[model samples]
Target: MRPLTDQEMKVVLDKLANYMSDLKSLIAPLEDGDRYVFRLNHNRVYYVKLSLANLATCVGRDALLSLGTCLGKMTKSGKFRLHITALPILARGARHKIWVKENGAQPFLYGSNIVKAHVGRWSEDCPEHQGCVVYSMADIPLGFGVTARSTTEARRLDPTGIVCFRQADCGEYLRDEDTLFAG
Candidate 1:
């Protein structure tokens, strides 16, 4: 893993900015930090660790700061897909956040979706299949999810059903298993 070049930075930021709003504001400060690339089998993963604790505090003001990798992605096919990491979320915050109740936090941290009943708050205008940030009631981001139904349809459905499809979660990053490096 190594630092990204100017061209590489532009490519990544461009793709990420398209999906994440206010990305420019969040990533601008991070540009000065070191970015490392990890080639895992067929995927190219990139990550940037903020240089200081105050950087995260300035962004999200969260506690328990450590050697966490925020603002990371794995290249799929020829493009990059966002990996929900702590630092970036704390730094820039997601444009759309789906807040789930306490009962749902465990499931969500394990990559489960927010059922209609568990969903406490969601971006009202987020459409189906759009990527969104999933958070706990305390405002700590759990991971990423793709909206499964339109807001109107979701609201009309029963509370027991799933509202979004979980894509990634915090546990993946926190796990100590060798799966991440497995071939």
Candidate 2:
């Protein structure tokens, strides 16, 4: 594993900023005392402590399956794709969020797009095509997706109109059990 290059860091930060407005606030907690660091292994970005990362260097690359929290992976085309596993971290700093109604929770968990009627509440400033975290009425993080319409536009949409397009949902853990963490 190796530290992310300047270019890689920029790509990762830009992608993360899509979900959260302040990149510094999102990354501040992870850099406390330089105790933690981000590393790249198998193209996957991991948030690991410095000591553990040092120890991991002794192990062969192929033998090391994982380390710390798997933030996501860098694609061949140089794009950073956020993974479902990073939900908790992202949710903590989410600028815009959508709260799904009880009846809509199940369908969202099933990987369906959120519809206008299913929205319990949402950040009023959420813009169309912007990334936002999805939550249950109880405030549980369910997933993240891009808004299909702005709050103003959605207010006039029919109940069946799509509000947010599903990108990745928590249900993938169960639906893709075998391959979820495969190398």
Candidate 3:
């Protein structure tokens, strides 16, 4: 394909530059021609998929952010049909867990023989509220959108992604792993 015209390129670059910080709106309407460059967990540069329309395009620096941040954003309500392509990590040997709290009336499901569900102070004590449908380690997989349960008493939310990396270089996600999330 012919290169983008000078004017076309400028317009594209400007959109990219403008959508720098927390550009949620821009991302929401991104089209086939739109582009983005975001970082993996360890600040590793990676191109994002831009199939907003029919023709595919490339997103170079100035789009993506750390994986931790991205997953956190998705945890919110009304997430769009997002597409992501990146290196997949090896599954953790231990159990996978995620902690969640509904923003409104508590969410529940009917089990074979249960009528009770978690109510007030939901997620306050994971062990408690046995009736509610809170997140569990066994149901989760290693990837984005997995919110980390607070490791501390504060119970604050930390959106984290499990990327495979050595001790010295964590969060550096790879495009394709000969080894893992990063080279």
The candidate that achieves the highest lDDT relative to the unseen native structure:
2
Higher-TM-score candidate among 2 and 3?
2
Task: Give candidate 3's TM-score.
Answer: 0.17
Error of 1 at 146 (Å): 0.9
Q: Per-residue alpha-carbon lDDT of model 3 for 143-177, expressed as tens digits?
A: 22211232232234223321111111112233223
The estimated TM-scores of all candidates read: 0.67, 0.93, 0.17
lDDT of 2 by residue, 1-183 (tens): 899999998898888899987667544544446466789988999877787899999999888888988888898999998888888878989989999999999999998999999999999977899999999999999999999999999999999999999988999889867755655
Better of 1 and 2 by TM-score: 2
- Give, for candidate 1, the lowest lDDT window spanning 10 residues: 35-44
Clashing pairs in 2: none
Candidate 3's error at 155, in angstroms? Answer: 8.6
Q: Could you give candidate 1's per-residue lDDT for residues 1-183 as a string of tens digits? A: 334556556766665653577754544544556533322222333343435432433443232222344354445444555555533543255656688899988888776677999899888888877767777888877777778887888989898888988877878766623444322
Candidate 1, residue 71: CA error in Å? 4.1
Candidate 2: regions farther than 4 A off: 29-34
Strongest candidate by TM-score: 2
* Candidate 1: residue pairs that collide: none
